[model samples]
Target: MTPCGDTEGDENCIAAIEALFKAYGSLRYGEEVTQLEHALQCGFLAQESGAAPALILAAVLHDIGHMLHPDAAAAVAADQNDAHERLGAQALSKWFGRSVSEPVRLHVQAKRWLCLRHQDYWEQLSPQSKRTLELQGGAMTAPEADEFERLPYSREALQLRRWDDLAKRADHPTPSLSHYLGLARGLLQS
Candidate 1:
């Protein structure tokens, strides 16, 4: 069971991720809001933060779960259903392992925890994100958040959240797929 499995092995996960982005980035929400644009922004943020390649890949494809399942992103926030984590993890599993999946799962939990832990965090969320957080119970009870904070992964989750926050700049410059292609080959080996 190789990462690329039977899908024209040359494509690899990096190529697969890019294909997904290229295929979907053009679909508009309101005026011209495309998932493609948002993914590049997220990737740029991860790259700027010194997130390792796997994490940068996680950042790039975190929302592909939503693209594969559109209603999930539109009608439901990851918090309410936590589908983003589960879906992303499942999608990347074919080509990625713990290094990427761990952070992907934590990213959603981190979002919920952030909302509960920091009022400012909630304030900083984008309008669409804020609305989704409400649907996901952004205001988790103190006890619940405390329990989440107690998880061994809480720190990693928080770090992922910080990077997630940092990764939202629409104009951030991300390297082209060719740059990440080399990085991905080296990372899968590591």
Candidate 2:
């Protein structure tokens, strides 16, 4: 089952985490990275940035939407399908509050912004990054940029971007499935 609340050591949380692990045992992407791995790297980077527990959770779950559905990453661009950020925000909402969701939403925009603004950051991105850049509509006008900047999350957006850059798979260790229980526990209490 999809873990929701802060169940901590609760049976539901355990089951959820276990389910995730069972799902992850030997899963591998065809030629790309796995969602689980990407998320863990993002989480570790968030931790190194000293953001917050919830933000770490946000980064961890940010790409979880891809796990839930196929072609989700592709669906995000050229339409309004922010599958990664949107689904992550909703799933995390059950446990974390806006702390996690807000950042998730902004981070997608942050990636787009970084592509537009931060040249050095863009040049270092992997091939997958280049593809996503095209998919996410690399082209944006000044007015569009202005609206994006108004997204109530300039700081969070930048923070997420910085960590995302830091958390590339080569540099970071693989993600772990151990945090689900603790996160569920927190939600149950709150």
lDDT of each: 0.64, 0.61
In model 1, which regions exceed 4 Å deviation?
1-12, 28-33, 70-82, 150-153
Model 2 C-alpha lDDT per residue in residues 74-179, reported as the tens digit of each score? 4433233445667656655654578777787677677777667666767886666666667667745667667888877666867876766555554346546676
lDDT of 2: 0.61
Candidate 2, pairs of clashing residues: 5-184, 6-184, 6-185, 6-187, 6-188, 7-184, 7-185, 8-185
TM-score of each: 0.75, 0.74
Residue 17 lDDT, candidate 1, scale 0-100: 65
Task: Determine which window of 10 residues in candidate 2 has minimal summed lDDT.
Answer: 24-33
Residue-level error in angstroms, candidate 1, position 128: 0.5
Residue 145 deviation, candidate 1, in Å? 2.5
Task: Point out where model 2 deviates above 4 Å.
Answer: 1-14, 24-33, 70-82, 180-184, 187-190
